[model samples]
Target: MDERDHASLPEGTHELSSEVSERVRSVISAAEAAANAVRHEAEQSAQVRGRIAEEEAIRIVDEAKGEADAYLAERRRRISELSDTVVERAEKIVARLDRAEEVRRQLQGLADSLGESAEELAAQLRDQPPPSVPQAAEAAPPVEQAAVAEPEAPEAPPGEEPPTGESEPPGGPEVVQLAEAPAEAGPAEAQAGDDRHEADEQLSARLVALQMAVAGGNRGDVEVHLRETFGIEDPVAILDDVFGPGTDAEKRVAWPRTGDSAA
Candidate 1:
């Protein structure tokens, strides 16, 4: 064969050149294998990071669920406690109302008994005779004497005339006797005095009633009735001072029995 035909043929190449080409191809294959190893390592790293992030997300969701459950439990407990307190308060109020009703019934019964007793006593007293007119007239002499003694001058004193020489002493300090004129008590004043006297008599009668009640061993009940009937501010003190603690001398001085004319 010719040289050109042999050079184009696969069996006509140089043996040394073929060996060099094979060595160069082996170096290139090794470099390509190293690049493939680096790419696989990067892929493995990304997969590890994704797994870690998924685990962290799951843990966070679990923690949030636990916190929500705890909040709900606490709110339920508070609501239960408040409901129990309200029920207890309602029970206490009902109990108090029951006690108050009982007390009111007892007080009403006591007042009714006292009223019946007082009515019976008053009826019995009304059946008895009052003081005689002669006795009442006999009781008036001492009061008349007291009224006469209380006046500044005697009822029948004589009038004296002024002397002519009494005016000559005016240059010196004049002696002017300033005596208060007697009040002209018209029908209105007389009516007021009569009302005052009637009030005093009624008060005296009530004082006697209170004394009788105390002697019969019912002072507290009598005092309650007195307060209810008369609307008194201090029934006990008034009763004690008027009926029990007052002396005869103090009564005679403080509430002197005057004549009707003085009244």
Candidate 2:
């Protein structure tokens, strides 16, 4: 081989080397591009996961808030229902008390009528006519010689009982005036009048005391006391017909109105 041929590269060797170097550089650049694509895909996946987590957290918070609101609303509804029930019961109690008080007033009116009737009856009895007596027979001689004659007896008063068998004096019976009978009775009539007046005063005092005891208190409490004090089976029966009607005298001792009683 000539010196020039030895110094120079073989036929196509340089071209082959140049081709191999170029192919290696192309492979390195392709690998670097693939790595960059993989990194970009990872970044995209991370961003998508972060967004999903944020959405989930927001949804959980919204759900929790919604549940809390519902719970609060339920509690408020229950409270409102309970309040309404309490108010209804209270109103019923008050209505019952008002009705009881009204009944008590009616009873008091009836008691008044009874007192007046009793007074009128007493006055009628006082004005009645006196009873008639039997006239005496003529004076008898000796018991064995003369026959005993019986005198006819007069009719008795409507209210008075007839006397038993008894003989009158020889003179006819003297009729005394009804007005003068009390004078003849003397101290007895005066004492009887005084006793009746005292009884009336005592009765009036008892009624006044009972009225004061029941005043301003609850109707149920007053009714209970009335039943116990009056020996009544039913307190409300004071207004019934069994006790008779009220009179002007009893009506004057009526209970005051609720508002007036407090004052």
Candidate 3:
């Protein structure tokens, strides 16, 4: 071979090298594209998972909030109902006590009147004289005694006895009828108490409903409930007595009793 030929590359070597280089670049580009696609797919999957997790978290939060709201609402309802029941019972007790006081006053007046009447009757009895007893009539004189024969019953034979069939009645033994016992007063009083208890229960139920209405803070509902529960048409009347005429507003207000001095 010549020196130039020796120095030059073999036939088709450059072309082959170029073709191999192209094939290698194509393989590298394809691999790079596959890796990019895989990375993109991973990113997308991660985004989807993150979104699902966020949604799940939001759903859990919403559920918890709903449960909490329901619990709070139920708690408020129970508290309001309990408060109304207590107030109703207290008012009823106060009313009954007032009635008892009035009854006591009435009894005291009646006793006083009875005492005065008894005193007048006693004075009249003392002023009148006792009546005298009547005298007995004179006794008659006794007559002379005379002898009289005595009659005797006939005796029975030794082997026979007197017959008692004619002396005995034909019917059965006599039965005595007893009168019925008087009805007790206790049953009437118990019936009255039962009626009162049922009325109290009804009033308590109405009062609880009224309290729920008041909790809603509607002015019309408050007025209606107040009138139905307490027989007070004006809602302002409940608070109007706090500072009445001749009362000091600056004084202490948490008194133990109605007549207690706030100061």
The sequence of per-residue lDDT tens digits that candidate 1 reaches over residues 12-87 is 3667567888988988888888878888888888888889999999999999999999999999999999999989
lDDT tens digits by residue: candidate 3, 1-263: 56586459776876787799999999999999999999999999999999999999999999999999999999999999999998998788677666666765675565455545544554444454443222221111111111112233366688878756574333212211111111233455556765664454344433433333223323344445546644544444332232233433232223123233211
The lDDT for every candidate, in the order shown, is: 0.55, 0.56, 0.52
Give residue 134's error in model 1 in angstroms.
Answer: 11
- Cα RMSD (Å) per model? 20.7, 15.1, 26.9
> Candidate 2: lDDT over CA atoms?
0.56
| Model 1 weakest lDDT span, ten residues long | 174-183
lDDT, model 1, position 199: 55
List model 2 lDDT by residue over 1-263, tens digit each. 46686459786876787799999999999998999999999999999999999999999999999999999999999999999998998788677667757987886665555545544544444464433332222112322132234445798899988876454544323222333454455556556766665454434333433443334333344445445543445544333222224422122233546554333
- Colliding pairs, model 1: none
Model 2 TM-score is 0.36
lDDT of residue 130 for candidate 1:
44
